[model samples]
Target: MTSLELQRTNLPEGLEELLGPKGLLTGEEAREYGRDFMGEVDNAPLAVLRPETTEQVAEALRLCTEHGLSVIPQGGRTGLTGAGVPSRPDHEVILCLARMNKVRWLDEKNHAMAVDAGCILADVQKAAADANRLFPLSYGAEGSCQIGGSISTNAGGTAVLRYGNTRDLILGLEVVLADGTVLDMMRALRKDNTGIDLKQLFIGSEGILGVVTGAVLKLYPAVAERECALLAFPSLPAVMKSFAIARESTNDRLSAFEMMPQNGITLACNRVPDVVDPVEGDYPWYALLEVSASKEGSGLFEMLEGLIERLMEEGLVVDGTVSSNEGQRAQLWRIREALVEAHNDMPHLLKHDVSVPISDMADFIETAIEKVQAIAPDAMLIAFGHVGDGNVHFNICHDLDTPDGSLATRHKEVTWAVYDLVQEYRGSFSAEHGVGSMKRDALRRYRSEAELAVMEKLKTALDPQGLLNPGKVI
Candidate 1:
């Protein structure tokens, strides 16, 4: 018998009703569910089951647990880390939550939204906007990435400068344990210091211990006034000075503070059509800055103009343009996001989603970049990210003409070099992205023996039989 035949477990009565033919994917259909976002993993699963309801998920997990079958939880399949990917062909099955995407409620009064684990991130953002609020978990994969995986990763994005990461925004969660026990703790109130904050455990755990079926997400007040500007700086120091001036002058109105190397802009213009270099002359560094005000008491244009005036007076910003309208604002933001697509087109790009203390960010980048250039001279370091949050999208992209993923292996070697510096500086290897199988060995290597042991103990305690997202995180 095949692994599928051997893996079949007795299901509870009336359990299969939640899935249609397409939902219960098997055999050849199960082939694609084994891997993840980066195409790093190569495991092919035995079965790919998609259940449309939380009840079905519980039932499936119950059976899988009882039979000692490992079940992998998947989201949009867009995660760079292989958190959602299956590790084994025969012993593992994929439980895709794509269909249980119903938004249970949007409590605008409490500034909270409750949604199913399967709901797409972009859709959740739209749902919040329609309710005249802001659900600020966003990134490149917002259009397809699910909330569950994003939560598991504790994703940080562009707006982290102001809104914070997935870890900070979540209020409550409804998680189904490895043994299929449903823990519905989806409360909206924020000040419940009553007992331990149980939901925080599942937030960044990468689904190793349990499956998140639903969530209660915190929301922010709608932005009333907004201003965006792209400023050119002669050096990283100048950019840092301008950022400090803006933070002091704007009085926390600053929404985003993004740092980009000049070559990244050039690459974006060349590889991606309709993407233009915003500045007139070549500057070494650029800052894509946006500030939003909630009450509309202060005019965004006035705030931006004042900040830029001080910046220019101090010789921080060499050349800058404040957006006169919304279209221009979007164009500036587009450059930041579209630049990544162009960077992807460039061959031999080693990507690092890492963060350090804000105070240490500038020096860290300078030293890291210098170290990298010493090794790969022609190595174009196209850096950009939410610098205010100390999260840098430190990308080392080789020439774009040679488009091949094979050369990215060399980039991996360079990653070790950078990660070594990170450890020395007390920075993290995986910052925004969680440790899936892709970084599991690194995690084991870097994390203390005591920490790893504790993690494993917790994993074993929560998933005694090791049936839930096996071979991930720990």
Candidate 2:
């Protein structure tokens, strides 16, 4: 039988009745949620379940579990990896959290916000801002990505240098297990000496253990004074030195320290609209730095200006443009934001989100670029990312001069070549992007047998039938 016919034939008897017409979707409705952001995985799901309430999600999971049906927990479906999208859409049911979106409560006094898993991250940030607080988990997809997906991947964005990852920003989570058991630990507490902290397991678990239903997120004071600058560095070492000096001088006010290569900037300017390089002339490398202080009269702009001036004077910086206003700051940030879009304008790209120690970032990038060049001479290395937090989006793509070749043919070799170097540098193969189906094999190969065994045990203990997000991570 055909995939759709097989799915329709095997669907649980009470699924339709339990979900109602609007909640359960099939055919075109289900097909719409199939592909990811980049259309990398385009297989259609068996059905899509739009559960409005936590109880409905519980019921759906329970029914799917009873019928031995694997369900993929979906968020905004903006993930790069095929985590939210169904890889095996022939049989998998998509449990989308879009309908469950709600900002449950905002505690301004406590500097915490309780929100449903389905709430868009931008909305969450706005809610926090509405209360005169800051969410601090800023990313390119903030407007589209969901809270649950962000937490599931333990998203690390630009501000992770100061605020930490999504895992660190969250205090508690309300998760639904494979068998529909609700683990409600959503307490808005800064300190909890509770046993085990089961929430942490599900935070970065990528829905292997359980589906994140809701969360209580930490918040911070809103920035009263802010300064952003785009600086061109003479060398990688100079960028590193500038980072140290800025971090030390700013007194922990350094909110973001992003690194970008000239080639990537050129690509962005050529392909992406309104993407202008803030720093004039051609420079090998650049750094986008931001400093912010919540308190009024903090002299943050002066501090940033003085710091940049000192760096330029020291010969660490070749050229630079400091943001005079919020509009200018946004314009400065647009260069980094336009990178992925510019890359998509190309063909056959291999993106690797890897991380190493902060000190090793420059060396790792330098060595990896040379090694990748040796492997794929024609491939252009678009190296850039959050240098402050040691994460790099070391993406490789076909250059204009090279004849377009099959990316699939060279994918494995190029992957290993990059990953092997990442391993050598004591860096993680997968950084902000969690181990979805894309990096499952990498996890097995790199991780110790003992670690894999322990993970399997946890999987078995939590999801005995192996029904929740099967073929993802472990």
Best-fitting candidate, scored by TM-score: 2
Per-model lDDT:
0.83, 0.88
Worst 10 residues of 2 by lDDT: 400-409
| Per-residue alpha-carbon lDDT of candidate 2 for residues 266-304, written as tens digits (9 for 90 to 100) | 988998889888676999999899988899799887888
**Which tens-of-lDDT digit does each residue in 211-297 have in candidate 1?**
999999999988888899999998887877778778888878898999988888887887777888768999999999988976776
Tell me how candidate 2 scores on lDDT.
Answer: 0.88
Mark the regions of model 1 whose C-alpha exceeds 4 Å error after superposition: 1-22, 401-413
Q: Which ten residues in a row have the lowest lDDT in candidate 1?
A: 6-15
lDDT top scorer: 2
